[model samples]
Structure formats: C-alpha cells, structure tokens
Target: MHFEVPKVRMHSLREFAQHYFMIVLSILTALGLEQWIEHTHHRHAAEQASEQIEVELRGTLDSIHGALANNARQVAPLRTLKEAISDDVRRGLPDAQINQHIRELKNDFVLSVSWPSFATQSWDVAVANQSATWIDIDRLHKYATAYAAQRDASNWVTHDSTIALNGPRMVDLRTRINLGKDVDPVEFLGILQQMINTSTETSGHLEQTAKPIERALAEATN
Candidate 1:
C-alpha cells in the first residue's frame, strides 16, 4: 500500500501542538461518523426485521383463532351427540333402535379437532441472521414468550390427540357408525365421551397459549 505524509513545517511548540490536536480531532470525528452510520444501518435493519416478524405473528395468531373456533363448533356438536347416545343407552333402548338413531344423526356424530402449527419462519430467519440481536431486550423477551407458548400448546395438543387418546379406536367407531354398520351403543358412547374430553382439553391449552400472544402483540403496538 502507498502512504503519503503531509507536507507541513511547525514554526514552534505551540504550532506543533495545534497541528497534533487537529490531526487527533479529525481522526475522532471520522470515527464518530463511521460509528453513527453503522448504528443507523443496524437500527433500520432491526426495524425491518421486527415489522416482518410481527406480520407473520399476526397471521399465526389468526390461524390459532380459526382453529379454536372450529374446535369449539366441533365440541358442541360432539357433546350433543354424546348426550343423545347416553340417553338412549339409559332408556335401555334396543341395539337396533340405538344403531338406527346414531346412523340418522351421522352429521352431528362426526368429531373433528384441528389445531394450527404456528408460522415462525420470519422469526427464525431474523434470529438466524442476527437481526434479533438488535431488538430491545424487553421486546425480545416478549416475542420469545409468545413463541414459547405456541410451541408448548402445539406439543400438548399433538400428544393428547395422537398419543394419549385412543384416536384409532374413536375413528374406527365413528367410521363404522357413519357407514350404517351396527355398533354397541354403550361402547360407542364411551368413545364419544373420550372425544368430548380430549377436545375440551385441547381447546383449554390453545386458549392458554393465546393469552401470551395477544399480550405480546398488544404491547408491541404500544
């Protein structure tokens, strides 16, 4: 690299001191400008990242709300079906009569519980690209808490629906009854009871998760 030295002659100690101070001041000013520019760039990047993440979170929250509503709709009808079946069994109705009644109410006898898998691609990319490091710590904590809640609720639902519950048996019973095949009323009632219980619990966890997400979004807006 080529280097150039300034052509200067100091006439006295005072002149030399002034020249040295000027050089130091110029260097400091240059450094300050560079730091300022870098800080501005980082702040802008952080803002953009935050905006993208928030938008994605809004979509995720919408998905969650939709799922909750759908499950709510499903739970009500499932409960009604269970109650009807219970009554039929209580009245000591014949297997043929109970079977025919269940087949007739096939629409209400159906059970469906759907839960959302929240979108986190934006947040994940921000974290991976180090943009999250620029976010304020308090805000970052809030975001983290919201995402944590989503993850926990998702895991719980997965376990309850797939592992803990007798999902296969329930589906099989539902299919047989819907297809106009004979199913023991008491046995079918038990499965319907399980479905009602599982859906209620899933909705509870989803509602619990929603609270943190709602709070985070509200605070972020303010």
Candidate 2:
C-alpha cells in the first residue's frame, strides 16, 4: 500500500503520529480479513466432511439391515432340515431312512451365510487429510465412535468365526451333503447347532454396530 504524502511537510509530531497510526490500522484490517477467510474455509471443509461421513453411515445402516434379513433367510432352511434330522434320529430311524428324510428335506441345500461388509472410507479419508480435525469436537467424537464400532463388528465377524466355528468339519459336512453321501445324523445335528449359534452371534454384533451409526445419523439430521 502506498501512503499519501502530505501536501505540506509535517511541521508537528501530531501529524507524524496520525500518519503512523493510519498505516498500522490498514495493516490490522488486512490481517483481520485474512483470518476471517481462513476460518470460513476451515468451517466449510468440516461441514463437507461431516456430510460425506453421514452419507456413508446411512449406507452402512442399510447394509446391516439387509444382512440381518439375509442371514435370517439362510437360517430358515437350516432350521428346517435340522428339525427333520433331529426328529428322525430321535425316532431311532435307521441310516437309510434318515438319509432319505434328509434328501427330501434338503434336496438342494447349500451351507452359506451372509456377512455385511462394513465401510469407513469417508471417515478414513477425512482423517488422512486432517479434515476431521476441523470438525466440531462433539460431532467428531460421535463420528469416531460410530466408525470404531463398525470396525469392531467387522473384526468380530472374522475372529469369532475362527474361534467358534469348526471350519474343516463344516466343509466335510457340506461335501457329504452335496455328494448325497450318508451322514451320521447325530454328528450332523451338532454341526447344524453350531451354524445356528454362529449366525445368531453374528447378528448380535451387527446390531450393536448399527446402534452408534444410527445414532450418529439421527443426530446429524437434528
């Protein structure tokens, strides 16, 4: 900035003081404007990051609901065949009769279960770029809690399966069923119980994860 030169040379200290303060005021005003602009930018960035994360949470909620439904559907057929086999064995039916009952109850059964793929891509990106730091403290905390729960659920799905499920035995059962080979009814019954237990536990974990995400989304709307 160029300063205005006085038409007449300054003849008093008062004039010089007036000129100096004008220059200082001009510099302060410019600095204040820059600070305001920076604050606005950070605020906008935080808002955008929050919006993206909320959208992702909604998608995750949808997947969780879908998974719960899908798993229920898978369990239905399992329960049906499990009941049939259990009844036949309790009745002291011979292996041939049990195998025939099983064939009729589960003609094309496939052992399978659905596991939801939880996502935190938006949250991860926000953190990587430091945009999450710009968010309001309370809001940031909520978002962090939601994503952390999602991660926990995902990890639990993996860890629980390894710890609680009999992978090799389940594979053998599935193979036998597929080949129409005779299965020991009592042994097969135990495996079905395991499958049902795993499915229920998985649903429990997903439901827990869904709670924080649903709360976060609800708060965002408010």
Candidate 3:
C-alpha cells in the first residue's frame, strides 16, 4: 500500500518570517541607543573642558587686576611730586632749589616706584598668555605696552630737561644768578606739566578699558 505525503504548513512559514523581523527591529533599536549614549558623553566632556578654561582665565584676570590697582596706587605719589615741581617753578622759587627738589623726586620715583610699575607689567604679560578671549588679550597687551613706553619716554625726557637746566655739570645753574638770568622757568615747567598730563590721561584710559575684561572674567568664572 502507497502512503500519502502531508503538505507543508503555510502558517509555519508566516511565524518564521515574523520571528526574524522582530530580531532585526530589536537590533536596530539597540544600535540607535548606543549611538545616542556616545554622543551625550562627548558633549559632556567638551562642556567640562570649556568650564575649566573659563575658571582659569578668571583667576588670571583677578591677579592682573590686583597688580594694576597696586601700580595705580604707587603712581599717585609720583603725580603729587610732579604737580609740586610744576607749582614750585611757577611760584618763582630759585631755579637751583627747584632743580634740587626735582632731582630728589626723580631718585625716589626710580628707587621706590619703578619696581612696582614693572611688576604690574609682568603681571600683564602673564595675563596675556592666560587670556582665552582675543579682545581682552589684545587690548590689555596694547594698553599695557603703550602705558609703559609712555612712562619710560617721559622719564627720559625729564632727565634730559633736568640736565639741560642744571647745566653740563652737577652744579645747579638756577642758583647761579647769571645762569638764572637766561633760564625760562615757564617753558621748563610747561614741558614737565604736559608730560604729567599725558601720563595721567593714559592711566585713566587703561583703567577704563580694564573694567570690561575684569567683568568678562568674572562672568566666565561664575
């Protein structure tokens, strides 16, 4: 007797297809989740780096500001001395006495004040290196250099003028009645006063420009 063979079931084929589709869907979902996690981690790391940079910049700026403030304070006495010299010359004090006073003042400025001014400049250079913002770095460097150059130039000019008025030797010409006869006190005082005024104005401008940098640093830290 011949046995009848059973037909393949259509339902089984459909069930197998559904099982494979479910596996593919699950795999796709896992891949998507992994990619999202990696992206999030990378973003977090970048943000952390940015925050650390900002903190460092702020600390640098604060130190720079302290140095600037101290330097400004040191300059105050120099301003007073300059004004006094100008006033003395205007008052017709003997040229010899005025020259003597100016020489002493210059000595004191070089000995006592110059170091702190130089220190402030060093701080500025350091800050320029630490600066993250281009504007802050550029402006600070420019202004600091300008101010320092101006101060040095003024000092040189004053030194030369003093030498000219005092005559070729250390002898005070102002005290010599014959030499004083030819000296123009007004012109000498005018030159000194103009230098003082320029220095003062430059200082004010630097101070004003520094505030924005300070504020930006503060905000970055916060």
Candidate 4:
C-alpha cells in the first residue's frame, strides 16, 4: 500500500528569470492601461463639470446685475416719497394729497417682485455626485465662497423686499392709502427709510458677491 512520489519538472535559471519577467511585464501593462483609463474618465468628468459651472455662473452674474439695477431704481422713488411725506407734514398738505402720495409710494415699493433664482444646478449636481472633489482646490474654494455669498445675498434680498408681508403691514398700508386715513408722516418716513436702507445693503452685498463670481469665471477661462 505504499504510494510512489511523482517527479516534478524544474526550470533552468534563465528560463525562470524570463518567465518572471514576462509576468511582471503583463502586470505592469495591465496596471498602466487601467490607470490611463481612469485618468481619462476623471479628466472628462472635470471638463464637463467645469463647463456647466461656467455657464451657470455667467447666468448668475447677469441675474445679480439685473437685481442690483432694479434695487437701485427703487431707491430714488423711496427717497422722494420720504421727502414728500416730510414736506406734507411740515406744510400741512390736504389729506387727499397725502393719500395720493401714499399711493405713489406704494406704487414705487414694487413689493412681491421676484428675485432671480441663483443658478446652482450644475454645482449642486457636482457636489451631490462627489465630482467637485476632482476640481482644483483653490478654484473650488473660490467658487464655493462665491456661491455662499450669493446665497446670503439672496436671503437678505428676499427678506428685505418681502418683510412687509409678514404682518398686517401691506394690508394696513393699502387700507390706509385707499381710505385716506391720517398716518403720521414721521412713522411712514421711517418705514420708507428702512426699506431704502435694506435695498442699499442688499445691493452692496450683491455687488461684492458678484466680484468673487467674476473672479471664478476668469480663473476658469484662464
């Protein structure tokens, strides 16, 4: 019941070296091709993300400019209304004229106007898919900062413009103006001044936010 041992074949030293060399070459080639494919895929993703971000940023910049312009236009009329109310109080203008002035002020207020939705679709997608991690760190930082500023400015703008809607402010305003109810000029002036101040602050913030976005765009192009 004894078992016979089988003889094993052995390679010559040169043959062994050649065989290992071929194995090493095959592994290296496979690794190289895999790395090249991965590099290509990452590069393509970055390029696509960049293009989408660039277009979205441009649209955002335009929206900021338009919003700023509209905000500025509201300022002059608000200032005029403030002055007119002051004069009417000081000079004792008729109640009818006062009501008319209130109407004018209301017309100028432009409440309920829509602000531009900051276009962040591409950025959001990049972030959600983790593709933004592939971007240059410095560029990504700048873009992120710009978007943050945009978000803040938008919040302020929306709050300031629509704050009057929170209570009976608009309702009271319309009723008072329509009915020619006697409103204290000083009180109304304060409200108008507050709105003007909010607009000024919002516009300034938006302008500052725009600079970073512009910088981001320049960096992207360069």
Candidate that scores best on TM-score: 1
Residue ranges of candidate 1 with Cα displaced over 4 Å: 1-5, 178-181
Cα lDDT of model 4 by residue, 165-185, tens digit: 333554566567667575655
TM-score of 1: 0.89
Please report, as a residue range, the 10-residue window in candidate 4 with the lowest summed lDDT: 1-10
User: Compared with the true structure, what per-residue lDDT tens digits does model 3 show for residues 1-222?
Assistant: 222333445478787677667667777787888888876765564455335444544454454456457556755765676578778876889977876666555532321212212123333444455432323454345434434543564465455423322233212322332333333445545544444444444445445544554554454445
Local accuracy of candidate 1 as per-residue lDDT tens digits, 1-222:
222335699799998888788777777787899899989988998888889878887888888889899999889987888888788888999999999989988788666787877888988998999998998888788888989998888777656554545778878887897788999888888777777877888878888888888887887789
- Per-model TM-score on C-alpha atoms: 0.89, 0.87, 0.50, 0.78
Q: What is the lDDT of every predicted structure here?
A: 0.82, 0.83, 0.48, 0.74
In model 2, state the lDDT of residue 115. 75
Measured with C-alpha atoms, the lDDT of residue 124 in candidate 3 is 44
Which residue pairs clash in candidate 1? none
- Candidate 2, residues 1-222, lDDT tens digits: the string is 455554657779998889778778888898899899999999999999999999999998999999999988888888888888888888899998998777676643445677777778899999998999999898898899999998787777667654676768978977887788988888888877887878877788888888988888888988
After the best TM-score superposition of candidate 3, give how far the Cα of residue 220 lies from its true spot, in angstroms: 4.7
